[model samples]
Target: MTIRTAVMAALLGAALTGSAVAQSGGDVGGVWQTQAGDANVRVSKCGTQLCGVIVSLRDKIDPRTGQPAIDDKNPDPKLATRSMIGVHLFFGMKPTGANTWSGQIYNADDGKYYASNVALMGPGTLKVEGCVGALCGGENWSRVSR
Candidate 1:
């Protein structure tokens, strides 16, 4: 290709890459809003490990009881009364890479614990995965406010 054509192609490539990078953030820490927009979670350092906590909910009150929503699905009876807000989604997650961690995560939807991994895909994206035996599934969370 001619030099002028090559330069145009390179600029186009750079522009596309820049756009993707703009959409993807570079840092992991921040409050992230889930895909469903039902809740906001703050992932931060809890001592030596990173932990995620439910900070806000779209529906904070339980419709059935007209009170605050709770972790009714928790395995431990003692924890069942705890509110959904401030509940730990994943704790004891040890860093496995510069922006990844491996640990167990609580699934309120199923009220069970599963092997889980958290990775920073980009500044604006976080990849969270949970596994039951060999089956694994995950969703991407987006940064709301840094």
Candidate 2:
């Protein structure tokens, strides 16, 4: 009877430990960089998995023209589109594995949709690869302190 009790306790402990590991995705919370810019991203579970959301944007300047990144594709040409600020920008994301994620990425600049994937290169860096149909582009972004 004593041996049976010990075995049961051990089994219960193992199951509990596994549950905890699955809940935590090996340290996945912090300011992660993306191809667009440094974004304050919150990594958390959605339903039974994990995802990230953009909380901030860094260097609102457009790297290509050294000017402000503006949304010029709005049908309402009279709407004074701001440099940065919009919803449905990064609607949702899903975790793929160790620092990798896949989801829809909204391009505020051109008002286009692209299938996007993100790879956290390090605590201070990340790689964002995005594709539209057969065309794709990628870039590395550095994390912001905030």
lDDT of each: 0.83, 0.61
Regions more than 4 Å wrong, model 1: 1-26
The residue-level lDDT of candidate 2 at 44 comes to: 48
Model 1: weakest 10-residue lDDT segment is 18-27
Candidate 2 per-residue lDDT over residues 44-138, each given as its tens digit: 45654445555566866768768765556654565436545333443355565556667777665576667887666766666767788778788
Give the Å error, residue 145, model 1.
Answer: 1.3
lDDT of 1: 0.83
Largest TM-score belongs to which candidate?
1
* Residue 11 displacement (Å), model 1: 41
Highest lDDT against the true fold, candidate: 1
Model 2 TM-score relative to the real fold = 0.54
